[model samples]
Target: MNHDRSHALFTRASELLPGGVNSPVRAFKSVGGEPFFAQRAQGPYLFDVDGNRYIDYVGSWGPMIAGHAHPQVLDAVARTMRDGLSFGVPNPLEVTMAEAITSIVPSCEMVRMVNSGTEATLSAIRVARGATGRSRIVKFEGCYHGHGDSFLVKAGSGALTFGLPNSPGVPKALADLTLTLPYNDFEAATALFDEVGIDIAGLIIEPIVGNANCILPREGYLQHLRELCTRHGALLIFDEVMTGFRVALGGAQQRYGIAPDLSTFGKIIGGGMPVGAFGGRRDLMRQVAPSGPIYQAGTLSGNPVAMAAGLATLELIQAQGFHDALEASTHALCGGLEAAAREAGVAFHTTRAPGMFGLYFREGPVESFADALGSDAAKFGRFFHAMLERGVYLAPSAFEAGFMSSAHSEADIAATVDAARAAFAVVAAA
Candidate 1:
């Protein structure tokens, strides 16, 4: 467990980067260790700068669906790079990428690609507000929509990991306009809608809730949200940054059978590239930029490399039986983890929404952010270190979800399960 190289790099990074990490969660405060620096990654494996290799269950925060450095994505990026990197102008590849996304995700009739998930959600908020002609937006507790000022309130993931649910710089006026509600509470949702339904411009939610670890919509939850919004004249925005293309080809909406007015997408769509997009009904989307009055634009949004990578990934996903195979692999991995933990006498809870899964060191099931907090985080911390020591990498925090990719082999899944069995024993006995 000699992380001296990582420590040294962290020290150097601190002088230049905030908290020695570009992102807050990477600080590794949750797992109680210096963050390992990645040097190289291949399918299912991450080689750290300290020369340690770990099975990467984090998958670069759920972007590496085809697994790290997929040959197809690499080849596409290389070919696109030869033509050019960024032109700061239109490219034919952008058209192809947009077409691919619109064709796959039903909600996205027209999409605007952005550089990151935060940008996608932020721009979608603008679009929603403009289309609805109202100022207030409602977000849910523990459903992270990105770091935009409006979304920074009561957020999840890195914001929760760092103990800053609401960052300081956001204006109180802006925060006031944004309301935070609890997930899976139809009564709470409708109550708010009744209270300020007309004043509220839109409601953005994570249909499957991945940030507080894969919390699925209970019973008639999504349909309720959709119906309530439509009945109250408020728009429904689905922040599918994690669930999009990972949960299903049509994302959470298709998986759950509820279509949102607007949807934000990221992760696997770009095949490990920096990409995000937001779209919905064509008339609603026409509110953006050149189409209408609402303003949103990007410089390197449709970069040739990113577009090419995304196009290749989408093509592969649609090519004969990919989703079914990916689901079977994910089911095996999650089932094996559950069995291994049980055999090791561990009080662990597991939940999944397709390829994404969440593990908790708790006795009962978790359905909400409050329920997710009931997990034995101390136990999770020890389990994280145990797995990392055994060369099986997991998400650095208990709140983040774990992902299984199509590229993960049966042997890799078995190794991950075996490591979890040993790690569970270590934590349970302690």
Candidate 2:
């Protein structure tokens, strides 16, 4: 519990890096505390610089599906590093990665690699606009598709955590072109498409929203979007960066039985490394860069090290029963926490989709960003600190979803529930 070393590091970091962290949420601003610096991570736990051990549920923000430091992923990265790091040129590993992703997710007939989720989404929007010759884009409230300028309107995750839905630097002209709608609301989407469908270039969504704490689309919701886009001549782009391999092998699209015109992937694909991709129908993807004239390029798009790590992670998740087991574990953990909250007489609600889950300090279902806002942020902050004190590390912001890893065991879930039981009592008393 002593974070002396971490405190010292943060003091120095605050003078150097903005907010003393590379990422905003990592500063623990929403949770009312300084962040703990991670010394190392193993299967399902993070050992902090202060020597406190915690059962990790964030999974490095949804990329460590096979868990931290998996031997296979490590070995693959090590082997690839022996050859070289960044080629800035095409590598065979990149081709293999493309093949692996295409085989798993049928929607991605061809893919272009990028360094981060933001790049993948930004590039995807560009392709959609170029291919369709439209200037407007549509996104849902509380659904985050990285920090691209067009996506900053009503953005979730870190933006929501810090109360900055609209950042200062984005131009009004650009913001005016991006439309926002409510997720799971079919009538609003239908009405909007009817009005300006022709001007809309693309509609991007997180099929299973993780940024607003794992809100699942209502029954027939995704299908409705697909149909609307087809009718409107707008490309349906699924941003599956967090849910790609974690929700299911083929992702939310496969689970929902809906195929989008384009898709963006990140997190699990990199296996803890920094990587991302955007792909879709051969005709649409062909319009990008050297293949055609859409023009999207990256110097480290297909870094050998990233490809090797991604390929290995994909291979491991493809094993039989991988998703089934992960889903069951997530269900178990969420169910246990609900029971704990009930026994503690606390108002609590939770939602789960395969390996991803959310916790809310409110009653009943949370269906959208508006509903998510009703949850008690201050109360959840107390619960977060309580659990952290009990050796369980959750996503610091209440707006962020918690991820379960294949590396997590029943014991870890059980220990987490026990901690939650005690934490809920503290919140209830407050």
Candidate 3:
């Protein structure tokens, strides 16, 4: 309940670090409060420096799927680090990770590891351009594929929360090369592809728009994109940095039964470490770096510690009924939140996938970026602080999706719902 220590830390940090945080959302700019600095996390709870414990739904922006500081993951990291930290040459863990990925997601025949989702996405687009020899890239309006220069145009997440969809300093020429389309719109996609499909190198999407608060693709929408890309000779890249391994075992592509030409991944694969990857059809991935002419390399591409943690996580998720339990938990959490809102006489809705969800201070059917923007963000901000005060940590911004983990027990979910009941009342009163 006390953020005094966090506040003191922020005072010192702000003097040296921009906004007193390494990441923008952590500043709580959208929620109108100073962020709490976490001391440690375990299971589904985060303990702040002030000794306050909160049930965590952000899951470190979607990597702690098995929960925070799982013994298995920690053990793997500890054991791997004992041998060495980084090796310039290829390590066996990297091969095992690649095997795990390719086997789980059949679409990724060959994968290249990177340090972050941003790097993976940047590398993917380059492969798209090099292979196709085209300059234009198409992305959806509310999909946040990291802060790559081209992706910042009409992006989501922190950019949307701050009202800077088109960030400054991106070259006008480069911005022009990146085209934007509304998600879940059939006609807009058709029209755009018809207009400049020839010039387009790739069309990348989030599969599930996690940044704009977890909007799902409409029926057959992904298939339509696949058809368009195939017909137009443009690569289809699924930016599954958020949805990968969270929505389903093989990500949204498998959940929706659509296959993409290239896919970029992060989050769960790292198991709370900093890692990312991009892979897809062999021909397309083969064009990246040493294999072909397109140059992309990372000094720590296959960090053994990260690989060990990720491999442990992958093993855990692959256990029987892991995804089924995850889906049930998501539904239970969303259903309870909706009921709590109803009891409080407040207008609220939630959109959910297997292990991720979005809360809106509005009615149902948040299918597009415009619908997401239509939510009462100011009211949501009030509710956010109220919930945080009650020991439930949702994502800092209404624009970001809240994650669920296999670590969250029914007791945790019930506690979260109870917290929401009181928090919703506060919102209603305000």
- Give all candidates' CA lDDT scores: 0.85, 0.91, 0.91
Give the per-residue lDDT of model 1 (tens digit) for 141-246: 7788888888787543321121233788987678878887788877788777888888888999998887887788898899999999999888999999999987
lDDT of residue 115 for candidate 1 = 88
Every model's TM-score: 0.96, 0.97, 0.97
lDDT of 3 by residue, 61-168 (tens): 999999999999999999999999998899999999999999999999999999999999999999999999999888887888888888887543321121233787
TM-score of 3: 0.97
Q: Tell me the deviation in Å of residue 116 in model 1.
A: 0.7
Alpha-carbon shift of residue 194 in model 3 (angstroms): 0.7
Instruction: Give per-model CA RMSD.
Output: 3.1, 2.9, 2.8
Clashing pairs in 1: none
Where model 1 places Cα greater than 4 Å from the true spot, the runs are 155-165
Q: Assess candidate 1 and give its TM-score to the true structure.
A: 0.96
